[model samples]
Target chain A: MNAYIDVSWPSLLIAASLLIANLVLSAVLRLGMGRRLLVAGTRMVVQLVLLGLVLEWVFDSANGPAVLVLGLLMGVVAGVTAVRRTSIRFPAAYLDSVVVIVTTAFLVTGVSVLGILRPTPLWDPQYVIPLLGMLLGNALTGISLGLDRFLTGVLRDRTRVEGFLALGATRWEAARDEVREALRVGLIPTVNSMLVMGIVSLPGMMTGQILAGAAPGDAVRYQIMIVFMIAATVSTATFGVTMLAYGRIFTSDHRLRSAGALGIELD
Target chain B: MAPPVDQAPILTAENIGCRLDNGWIWRELDVNLAAGDRAVLTGPSGTGKSLLLRTLCGLDCPDEGRVHHRGHPVLDQDRPRFRARVMYVQQQPVLIPGTVQENLELPLRFDINAGRITGDGTAAALLSRLGKSVEFLGQRASVLSGGEGQIVGLVRALLLEPEVLLLDEPTAHLDAEATECVEKVVLEWVDAGDRAVLWTSHDQAQVQRVRRGPSIDLGSAS
Candidate 1:
């Protein structure tokens, strides 16, 4: 009835031929990616199917609490993933990640849905859940890069930092450079994406919307909103996590805490 | 120049003990550095001479004792003030990115030194004493030789005018000329009165040249 076409099972089977082509190429090149490719492809299909079913029920129920709970669960997963992506391991790192990711994702999504999108009867699963997922995913990446750079910078240039401390600098003064650099490193990815969003690539939201038969102009506007939201959330998360992390790294005595306190070994 | 034994000690370590993963590096150590004192610390490698200096400057806490400055026990809250008064210069000095003048001006920018900014004339005078012209201040720090960088670091510490200077082989990387320049500047600094120094050196000749008071041999200590 509508311009959007349904992706039936028959069409999906036809698409499966692409995987055979990939497997044949991997085998010929002896890339050792044959098994990995198959496993990953299978996992993607299974996970997406599962998510589709869960999302169906969620949308049908139209429950605000259910949507919020699901968003929070995604945030927690994102938090754990962010910490694991960084080499700096600390006892309270996961807690730091969780706080930063959850707060930024919630605030950005809340503002977008309630203030900008104004999806009727706020907390509408259709809008809230997807926006939350996108924000959480991007925020997790930014916070991870920030944390990694901050910790590694401190570790590498410890002598320079201590030199400042020895000259009577406060903890904040000693760490100012590292903190600024970390924030910059975190924001680079989102900034680069914004620079070439439409020309270099059609973003996921816009592409999906167009495939669903939405007007190009409307889809572009939504994509622009999503990018702006992501940039704000990522920067906010990076700044928040860097501030919390520096406190834990330096003690009240203005000395660098031992690696043991961070639950990691310094090589 | 012997210290005034009658005056209060500028710094004191009470039964100070330090340990490493291997075992006790030093134990039950006691020393008093009085005004105008120039004490030399000597030991073989691994005796933790630098570590001892770090502890005295409040950079490292001893496992079993405390350090005091002018009869006041050094605490966590008082560390910034304590470090300001008792400065420690490592063997290899670290310089932040900037010109020599900027490096010298850094300590003055600290909150503790807010009201005590060193005048440009003082920096010039200090640089002159170290065989550097006032124009040397404009030279980029990254381009300076190791010896020149060490001089900049020394001038920086001198501008702060700390009460006690814990020198960790400050001239280790310097040529004889540079070494003499450092010694000349430091000697003039201590001549001003009420200042003290504890320097570590393996060169007996340099020690004899610089030592105005007693030398403590940490290598022989238990």
Candidate 2:
């Protein structure tokens, strides 16, 4: 603090080295990864720089409405990005659905922290922003994975599904296996992480809490609460996305015309 | 040649064409099968014979063509319905990963209404038709031989009671005796007044047996 030394020089040097290594290794591998690497590195630098500036404004804003607006915008952008990764078509309603689900889930979780557990100043960037980011991040991942697995199941097992239709299964019945597979895929990582927690190593949340001078017992309790909340939010978001996706698989003729829907094919 | 329009042909292919990458496989191909008609399709290697049969089954789409089952298009949203009415058997049949009974019931898992036909009687009848005992139901799909798997696939399709049946090299891997058995059962199925059969073969003699209908030979185009 006494010496206003620049720490960004080390980070810049590491970033430059990474770019050079990526170019050289991509050429050696002959896989054409160099372009993607360059673009990603450049984008990351520009994005982070811009975000750092923007976040300064966010932190300085004393208005609660401004903070809430920023949070809502962040959740909507995150949800849209996650949906785009599935390469599936969605109705305009889907965006609204994602917005409502993600914002509500994340905010509820955030508010629980405000009133009951960690009594802090309202709209505190230190607590609310980081927690909102974490919850939204997990929810986004769960939604994408759930949508992908469900769509894949529908595409790859079209014959099995049609075979079900022949056997007199309704639309929902035909899609039951796909839904089950998607839900299992979404839930498995959370289940596995829960099983491995504390046995293999300390989780990141617990470590961060401890590092911030909280008691170990308190940190563990907060970590447990976060895990449970994340699991619940993920399940709810996954179910919502999938149910909406199913409606898109059918046509006006009441048949499963899923060939072009979501860019997914029934086998 | 076209069949009568009002008769509701079990399967029809109109102006079918197939091409992949830079190669042209077949063009403007047409065929029709009414109830109880038996047809054999023969061609040399890479003549698009399998592609044509696959197109009939709604598995492969032609570059420019239309397929109809009972006078209904079998493409896009209509495919699931057509697939229910017509079953396609591949050369090396795909067995859904499960026990034999589970594989048989896989189609039922999709359509709950089809679950009604999943009782003991249907399983027994299908097994007997293929000269298999009901005990084969509990066997694992992974443990079956090539012929056994094909038989199971056929029996599974038969349980659906499809109106039209399409086969690709049905006897390619079967022994002489097994081949004869499959032919007999399939011929019997085709003889039923409400059903039809279209099959592919490389053996000239096999194509000649049980002369019930016409044979479309892919000439020079190979």
The CAPRI quality class of candidate 1 comes to: medium
Error of 1 at A119 (Å): 4.4
TM-score of each: 0.88, 0.69
Give one clash count per candidate, in the order shown: 0, 10
Query: Candidate 2: where is the Cα deviation over 4 Å?
Result: A1-57, A62-124, A140-175, A193-225, A239-267, B1-6, B18-25, B60-63, B73-79, B112-135, B218-222
**What digit string (tens of lDDT, one per residue) describes model 1 on residues A1-267?**
129988997889779998889899999999999999899999999989998998999999989888888888999999889888998768698898898899899999989987899987799999998998889889888988999999998876777877777888777777888999999999998999999988998899899999999999999999989998999999999899888989998878777665765677876
lDDT of 1 by residue, B74-119 (tens): 7676677778888887676678788888888887656877766556
**Candidate 2 pairs with clashing backbones:** A88-A262, A164-B110, A164-B111, A167-B114, A168-B111, A168-B112, A168-B113, A168-B114, A169-B111, A169-B112
Residue A33's lDDT within candidate 2 is: 89
lDDT of 2 at B154: 80
Name model 1 segments beyond 4 Å from true: A9-43, A62-65, A118-121, B1-7, B75-78, B115-119, B133-135, B213-216
TM-score of chain A of each: 0.94, 0.77
